[model samples]
Target: MHVPDGFINAPVSIAAGAVAAGAIAVSLRGARRELAGGSPTAGFEDNRTAPLGGLVAAFIFAVQMLNFPVAAGTSGHLLGGALAAILVGPYTGVLCVSVVLLMQGVLFADGGLTALGVNITVMGVVTVAVAYGLFRGLLAVLPRSRRSVTVSAFLAALVSVPAAAAAFTLLYALGGTTDVPVGKVLTAMVGVHVLIGLGEAAITALTVGAVIAVRPDLVHGARGIITPLKLRVNGELVDAEAPAPDPVRSGSRRAVWATGLATTLVLAGVVSYYASANPDGLEKVAADQGIDAKADQYEHATADSPLADYGVKDVEDERLAGGLAGAIGVGATVAAGTGVLWVVRRRREDPAAPTHRSAGTAV
Candidate 1:
């Protein structure tokens, strides 16, 4: 949910900004180890995943444009930090949501650049940390099946949305520009967002289940717990001595790249046009609580850009204008995300690292 320009005061925004900066800094270093370690295919020297990470960010960006209606007026988009982390990796997932937030802030003026830190902290950090924590906890106690992984994903996403809503209420109470009681804000926000959480859980589960079924190795949440497929020569069947990971016979990193990019393009270029035309979670709460009074206008880098505000300037057709703008967003976000991940991945790749152990390319 975009907080817009006004909801939070300057002091709280600044504090959030500092916290976001520190989190992003920490995420970058963590991503280096995550991208480098625990994967057979994604080697310490592999720069291939840079493009993949970028595609994930763009995918999340496009998906966020398709808001599903939760009630009469309030809708919700995919708060993808947990889903992305489960699909990719935690550090990369954090980076992915951060990229989406950054693009929305600077390009579309959806979120405030001044409050970029706040958005990332709330949406990216909080969701990822909460989702990953719960996911790991469940995996520790449950059977290490792909189905278990998918179940955990659903539960993680379900919890993260409400947790974010609670966090927003707390932040607003600290820096609200309103005379409304904190208890009222908390009750309304949590009540409405519980419905929103169902949507989040569905998307997270479906996406994670699909990827885990195909490319379990590529799944960040499924990492370090994979049991490779083994062929029993005498028995004439493929099996595992231990608990087996879901087969990835047709799933590869290349396949994930192709599928993810295609999904992003389709959603942004075609499907986003049909998304419900209702305000999202934050917008509804703001209007209900009179939090829009101090809302300032956004100063976006793309304010003068032809494809600003998800509409192509001079395109009379609403469908056409939105379609073109959505496509542009997908393309730009993918490129920007790739560039950032490239730099991050390049710096940590040890070019001369061993090749014998990491020889296979299934991942």
Candidate 2:
């Protein structure tokens, strides 16, 4: 959820800011390893990680715009932590959500600038941490199949949404600007978000399954865990082992990247127009519980931005304005996310280090 400016006090906001900063810093370092093809079967080099990470961020941004009705008078959008972590890596997933948050705050005026850190802490760090941890644990216990990966993605996303809600409740207890009872807030937040989590799980599992079907090697979580190819031997079926991963099979991720970007553009620019108009879970909870009493006192720092509120500032056509804003958001998120991931990749990819040949091709 996008916390507003006055929802939290100054001291706790600052502390949350520090926590966000620290998480980003650590993620940046960890991302270097992830982007460098560090996994046993991940043959990816800098190219795959950077472009895929950008696309993943933009996809998350696009999908987040499509808020589906979750309950009576309430809607929910994809939090995207499980999707990103499964597609890329956990560290890069955190950066993906962080990039989306930064874009929404500065350009879209969606999340309050003052609450940027809080949003990142709860949405980025908390969701990714919980989702990735649970996903890996489930994968360890479940059969190593594509279906298992999809199931893990679903379960991880299902848990992450409520976990994030709980984190927000705890933060509110420590630094809420209003006097709402913490127990009520927690119960309501958790209850509503549980329904929202079902939506999140469906989206996460479908997306992960689609990607795995097309390009399993590109999925960070699916790496080294795919069921081996089976061959019919003279008398029985047996595993067919590849002597070595074909470099060409690593192929160019350009096709997949381009396809993903196209899908992102369509979702943001066209599909977002039909998203549920009802207030999202957090907004509904805040309004019903009086938690946003002081939020009206403070204006968003980027309230005057051209793309504020996911609409063009001066565009008369509501559809045209929203469409344009969504397109712009996707482009900006892709650029910013790509830049950040490229930097992470560059820092760890030494000129002297041998190049890695990642497996799988989108075509």
Candidate 3:
């Protein structure tokens, strides 16, 4: 959940900011390895992973705009941590969610500036860490099949939402500005979020399964997991020979990217128009438990932005205004995410870059 200003006290918020900063820094470094395919020969090269990472971030941003109703008076949306971690690597996934949070806070006045670190810690860090861990564990035991990967994605996503909610509850208990009972807050937050997680699971499973069906190579988590089946020849069962490496077809990659971007545009620009208007899970829980009694306004700097609150200011048509804002958000997030990931990928490919052990020795 996006924590608005004043939900957490200044001291705790500042501490969380430090934690978020550290985590982001570490992730940036770790992402280099992930984008490089675990080793020099394990994963997609920089050219492939960089743009794909950006697209993944933009997809998350767009899907988040489509808040599905979870309960009678509350709605929930994709946090994207599980989806990102399953599609991209875990470190890149963290950066993806962080980028979305930053864009939403500064450009859209969605998440509060003061609470940026809190949102990152709970939504970005915790969700990604837990989801990826569970996903890996499941993959370890489950049959190494495409279906297993999809199933793992579903279960990991299903748990991550409530885990994030639980994290928020703990943080509030530590630094909430109000006097609401911690027990009530935790119960309510976790309760509603459980329902939200079901929707998350469905979306994650379908999306992961679809990608695995089409281009499993592009999925970081699915790479090397699904092997070709065996065939019977001359009354003996033998492993099927691996197919010849297809020549790198830039056109195929471009087509996939174009299709994904078009889908993102459709969801954010049009489908979001019909999303549930009710307050989301956190907002409803806060209002019910009085945790939002001391909630403060967002930063004044973004108050007058033309795209504040996910709508274009001064536009007479609500649908047109929201559509424009969503499109703009998608564009900005993709650009920012792509730029960051490109730099990281470039560093990994640099001949002059120091190796991990070498840097450690120098230190």
Cα deviation at 142, candidate 1, in Å, is 1.1
- Stretches of model 3 off by over 4 angstroms after superposition: 40-46, 231-238, 297-300, 349-363
Off by over 4 Å in 1: 39-42, 228-252, 296-304, 349-363
Q: After superposition, how far is residue 40 of candidate 1 from its true place, in Å?
A: 13
How well is each residue in 1-363 modelled by candidate 3, as lDDT tens digits?
788997899988998899899999999988988888877444544377788889999998998998999899999999989999989899999999999999998999888888899999999999999999999999999998999999999999999999999999888988999999899998999999999999989988998898888788889899879877799999998999987866665677788888988999999899999999999999999888888787744344587788988999999899999999999999999999999999888776557665567544655
lDDT of 2 by residue, 1-363 (tens): 788899999888999999999999999988887887775224444378888999999999999999999889999999998889989999999999999999999999998888899999999999999999999999999998999999999999999999999999999999999999999999999999999999999999999999999889899999989878899999899999777855665454677888889999999999999999999999999999999999999998889899989999889999999999999999999999999999877666447766666677343
Clash pairs detected, candidate 2: 43-358
lDDT of 1 at 106: 73
TM-score head-to-head 1 vs 2, winner? 2
**TM-score of candidate 3 to 2 decimals:** 0.93
lDDT of each model, Cα atoms only? Answer: 0.81, 0.92, 0.89
Rank order (by TM-score, best first): 3, 2, 1
List pairs with backbone clashes in candidate 1: none
On lDDT, the stronger of 2 and 3 is: 2
